[model samples]
Target chain A: MANLVNYYIQFIKRDLQLAVRQKHEFVLPLLFFVLILILFPVTVGPESGLLARLAPAVGWINLILSLLIALPRMFSEDYENGWLEQVFLAAVSPSFFILTRILSFWLLYCLPLVICSVLLVPFMSLPFDIWWVLAQTLFLGSLLVAALGSVASALLVASRKGSGVLALLLLPMLIPALIFGSAVIEAAQQSLPYLSPMLLLAALAVFCLTIAPVAAAQAIKINLG
Target chain B: MFKWLHPYAKPERAYALANRLYLWLWPLALIGLFTGSLWGLMFAPSDYQQSDSFRIMYIHVPAAIWSMGIYMSMGIAGICALVWQMRSFELSVLAMAPIGAVFTAIALFTGSFWGKPMWGTWWVWDARLTSELILLFLYLGVFALFYSFDDKRAGAKAACILAIIGMINVPIIHYSVEWWNSLHQGASITKFDKPSIAKEMLWPLLINIFSCLLLFIALTCYRFATELLASESHRKWVTKIIQ
Candidate 1:
């Protein structure tokens, strides 16, 4: 157990080092998130009331699109560089390797989105109370996206042309997260005291956390074979 | 029993069993489809609320049920492929993709046909309809993934992983109507106690469902045979089976 924890710590530390060295990959999704939010009001016209009304959906859309853009890069670099192959051949179980990879990805890909969500709030005319709700929902919901992304990445790890199909496969499964996350913020906007949607979002997070690593591990084995 | 079944995992035996079953299945499927459609389309009583539009249920419901049903089967086949390293199971999953996609498309089409008169729109963002659309995409993704790679074994592995991941969506699709406050109605027939529909309606629906099941079996068998032939084209079995 101590060895497992040490392995995770090392994995996370290495991932952080990589993230710091190659900061563009981490920053791009955040930039995309802001750009999408900015484009929405311009596309829909500059009415604060209208923007406020559509804030929850806008936030949800930005979250999903940003995640989609970030997904292909999650494993493509590791797979291409043969780092993943080394991991597969390592002493660590594939399941543990995948879990550690997903954790690192969640930290790099999703944590930025949570920070960006705070910046996106004012542009959408989001209420101060709902900003916290959106932050919480995005944080929880991004974990689900990271988990699902891990499975998708593992599945497509071997394919030359995998990104397009990965999006088609992963996006549909994200509907539940999209719905629950958007609903929480929408409820907050309405001053409806939105706990149910947040609770559901947490449930989705728990579900994804439990199942995705095993699926991802299996996918990696198949792809490696 | 397990020993007896093990031989059929071999391509040659599977092809032989499929060949024999194909002859029998065609006739039964024809009879079932003809009688079932007649009973469902002509004889079933009109819904008190939906009138003739609900007749679409005869086709749509069965197709929808099979769409989910076949996906689960594919996932199981995938698990078998992954765990037991069964190439035949992988081939079966590849074969089922197009058939499942077809069923999902039919379900979605018939659903829209039903929805037009009932809901006054051809499409709605209802939970069931949305989930069914997602299922179709899942099927298409699997099919596309399998054919995308030049390496057949690699393609099959990729698709198998995809099948398992997509399986998570199946239960979500099934329960989306119940979980979300959407325009789609909840299940009427899946309940254990009794179905919500009248006996007259239920009987024909069951017949239609049976007919669809037979059709799916026939289609899957035909597809599996074709896949086996393609994969084993250089083998002695292909020459024997073709001749």
Candidate 2:
């Protein structure tokens, strides 16, 4: 068990190291998130009321787009460099490997989006309470997205046109998460009860965390075989 | 039984079975479809409120039920493929995609046709309609994923994973009306205590639903046979059966 913990920590460190090396790829999703958020204000006019009304939706859309932009490279780098096979043949179980990979992805891809969500909160003229709700929902929802992404990445690792097909398969499944997350923030803005949406978002996160690693592990075995 | 089932996992044997099955199914499907359609369209009583517009239930209800049923079937086929590593199961999943898509589309069209006369608009963001649209997208996504890969095995694996994950959406779609306050009426035919529809209406609805189910079975068998043949055209079974 201690060894498994070490493996996870090491995996995260290695991913962080790689992110440092490929700084451009790491920054691209952040830039895309900002650009997308900026589009709403420009397109919908600079009216504060309209922007506030659209804020939760804008944040949710950016969260999805950022995840998509970051998803293709989640496993491609290791798969291309033959590191994934090494991990498969290692002493670690496939589940452990998948869990570590998903955690690292959430840390790298989603954590930044959460920060960006905070930064963009003022642009949308969002209330403090709604901003808090958006932040919480984004954190949970992005974790779920990252878990689902690991499964998609593992499944598509060996396929041609894997990335595009991955997005097509994954984006539709992301709808419920998007709806729940955005709805929570929307509920907050209206000063209505936000508990139901938050609980739903958390349930989705738990569901993804429970099932995705196992599915992803199976996918990794299939790809390696 | 397992041994007997094992042999049919081979594409050729599956193809042969599907071919034989289709021969029996097509005739019965035609009989059921023709008989059901004639009865439902003409003999079924008109609604007290909506009149003949409720006749659309013959098509709408069956297609809606099938839209969910086919997804469940596809998900089961996917699980079977993953567990047994059967190529035939993968082919079934593939064949089910377009059939499921067609059923979902028919459900949506018939739903709108029913809705326009009843709801005074062709479309609304009501739970049933919204979820049905999502179901169509799910089918399209599965088909898109199936064709996206160059290798058949890899494609099947990816699509199987997708079908399994997307299964979560199915329950949400089915129960969306109950869970949320929506304009769409809850299940009238499927309820337990007593179905809301009268016996005169109920009989035709059941017949139509049965016919639709038979048609789906016939179509899936035919499509599975075609897929098996296409994928394994050079096999000895193909040479023996076609010639």
Best prediction by DockQ: 1
* Root-mean-square deviation (CA) per prediction: 3.0, 2.8
Chain B TM-score of model 2, please?
A: 0.90
For model 1, the superposed segments whose C-alpha errors exceed 4 Å read: B43-51, B182-202
| Candidate 1 docking class | medium
The i-RMS of candidate 2 is 2.6
Looking at model 2, the pairs that clash are none
Which tens-of-lDDT digit does each residue in A2-99 have in candidate 2?
Answer: 88788888888999999999999999999999888888899999999888888877887788878888887787778889998898888888787888
Q: Per-residue error at A34 for model 1, in Å?
A: 1.9
- Cα lDDT of model 2 overall? 0.81
Docking class for model 2 is medium
In the range B144-172, model 1's lDDT, one tens digit per residue, is 88876778987897798788877866776
State the fnat of candidate 1 relative to the true structure.
0.52
